[model samples]
Target: MRCPLARMTAETPLRYRFVGARGVRAWIAAPSVAQTQTPPRPLDPTEVETIAIIGRPSSQIAETLRRKRAAEVISDGVSAEQIGDLPAANLAEALQRVPGVAIEREVGEGQFVSVRGLGPLFQSVTLNGAPVAFNENIRNSTQSGRQFRFRALSVDLLAGARLAKSSTADMIDGGIGSNIDIETAGGLDGGPFLALRAGGEIEERTESLRPDLSIAGRIVSPDGSKGLVAGISQEDRRVRYDRFQIMRYGAFAVSGAPLTAPNDVRTTVEREDRRRRSAFLGADWRVSPNLKLDFDGLVSSFDNTIREDRLCPPSAPLRQIEGSV
Candidate 1:
């Protein structure tokens, strides 16, 4: 039980070396064979060359055609008008020129907007793309009636407002009145723009110096992919109202006494003083070409006080009767 080993010699044929396990135990080198192919060489500078061919140039002709088409498109959908320069305080006044629009003034200032006879209460007001309808707690009291007031809304935050006469499913409903879309400076399609305004007026009767101030700005990225807009506005106004009236009353004496005067006379006087202040801020973020995010906030304060005085004749015949009765 002995294992065998293979050995090779120069005279042994390579193919017949595996006759037995002992014949395979040796190393052998194969003869070299000639190659039929050669390696590729790099191309020389003189062998490489550039070819330039010229064709008819039409860049100028194409540009002129594009400009003419653009002008036609712009003319079809937009129109231009020369509106005289107006102060910020009178912005609403300027907007009155638009068709089917109306404005209401409170204390000689534009405080309410109406579209096509629709009242302000029913219409929705928005700053940029956000609604400005925040819950406002207003308290009203009457001597004879229950104390109640409506939610007070203000348009001081708007740089401009547009009226949407037609209705769309996407827009808010319940308004038979036209929609008043307020435009704040911070939300504009154009690049960044800034504006600031401040002014005051004097009351002839009260001699009060009422003042107003506002600051607004907008910024857009150079690539038009991102933008930021912000605005803050404040207004202070004072109003005074007065009324005077005289009344005469007639009554019969209960007891048979010499009736010198059977009628009573009185004079009444009433005065009201009001002060209002409002402020607002808004922002917009264009997250993508089809999606946008917006936020807005506003605060307003109104204080009003009324004073009344009455004067009646003392010891009049009617007064004496009333006292006796």
Candidate 2:
């Protein structure tokens, strides 16, 4: 049997349908009996519009590595996004993530930091390259050393932090071990954005929750040459600490032989209510293709209300052991 070839005529009908897109409904289009027989024409170049898309993708790790590679000295850093994603509450806690850096805790919160096993006094910390003063309200005011307390500042207001392991001519003195600098974003650097964050901190001893809140925003000029950024944060924390102290180890004669024993023993319990507030403001101006100026300012306040109870030996009666046994 032979099959006959089919021919299309104006009388034939044609139906076409297209898949639906997001926010668009699918529909069927049927050609008119007269239009189906018309010849196809090429599209006109002048009538068509050309569209182009440009994008630059960035992340905290990439930005950090870029800065590290570009810096003149041996340095490590963390970007703002990385800081925010970390499970850290304060600047000291965040700095612990850096290699060869360690932190000292007080009342379960990081307060002092050391670099490469060097003490806190050997390291220097700056806010936007400006020196930060020691906290006046720190415990044992008379014994306050050169170590700067990290408890006074909050992590939310920073754009990034850098730790320099080597010395540089432009850096300020006093950082024989290392230098740390925390920076805030300027208007043009952050672009135009507004963010509000809220969270809670739980203290295991009291079984109570504390509140934390922060607001950050940035505005850029229409010309894109100037901008300003600001951030404010407030946090409340409850801490309970128990401390045992052995004042000194002394040699005691027991039946003829000398034995080492603790001279005095003491115990203390501390309950603290801490409230911290920090604010940051920064502006950026691009004067020329190679010249850019930045201004950054930061202020923070830390309030600690403590209730402590101590048990100690009596000074006059229990202290005197006149002759060696």
Candidate 3:
């Protein structure tokens, strides 16, 4: 008797299938079909070159000009040192090129930036076009003897900054020294553009490495009705500073029979490490060709720590720690 063929079902076990059998052989023997190939299209070298040469469109150029103008206005008349580069570690370093701006260094690094003849506390700093006033607990006062430090604000977040020496009704009421305005850009253009910058420096005296990075981009719709822009940056830096402090004694030396030494000598050394990070986001709605509505948001954070030590010879006992750390 002939062997019976097994019936196939959707759920049949794999090991039970019939192989090399009469029914399977007929179903598996089918002829192969041929596929036709299409000819390749030729590349137009001229068109490719033209597209490359055209590069960014005219609208993009205009947007670039606008940004340049804004930066120039903010830096106008400022010294090269003061405005050396936008993303400096602190206002003092940023303003070093400006005339009348003085920076006190500790251990060959900038400790504080002084404007005109005013102290650090006398200066006011603004962020994102808004004033960053001191809290009630940290109010500004001469007697308080506390001052603002440039390291407190993030340099990365600022696309541009302006130092205003003269007073204006629109500015903060206080600050005989100067006012610092920090601005952020909103990435709201409907075009595709990208910008990236990074650098690192090694200081010989401090033996420290400084590194910085920044990225900015914009996306705009073809119709130009809407756009988005954004920027982000971070920096890590170390600075050294050295300076002298003067101490006076014996105010009534002329009248008194015996007077203490009229003056004392002292030296100070300081080391500072700072880290900063910042981000900005902005959107634009084109209400009209010449007029548009823009909204921007910015966030920035900075951390700075200083280490100071004083040394004097054993014979010169006059040197002593005077202030609380």
lDDT tens per residue, model 3, 37-62: 44468877664444444565454335
List pairs with backbone clashes in candidate 2. Answer: 187-227, 187-228
Residue 6 of model 2 has an lDDT of: 20
- In order, how many clashes per candidate? 3, 2, 23
Clashes of 3: 23
Rank order (by lDDT, best first): 2, 3, 1
lDDT of 1 by residue, 1-325 (tens): 4223324343453433354754543445554343324446876767557899999745433433454365422111101111224333443454455676567664455545556776555555554445555334322222332111111323344444445565456555654555445544344345687777677777666688777666656777666655565655555555555544335445446464534443446655544565555565555677778887766655556565667676666534443343343
Question: TM-score for all predictions?
Answer: 0.50, 0.68, 0.50
For this target, which candidate reaches the highest lDDT against the unseen true structure?
Answer: 2
RMSD of each: 31.4, 16.1, 22.6
Best by TM-score: 2
Question: What would the TM-score be for candidate 2 when compared with the true structure?
Answer: 0.68
lDDT of each: 0.50, 0.82, 0.61
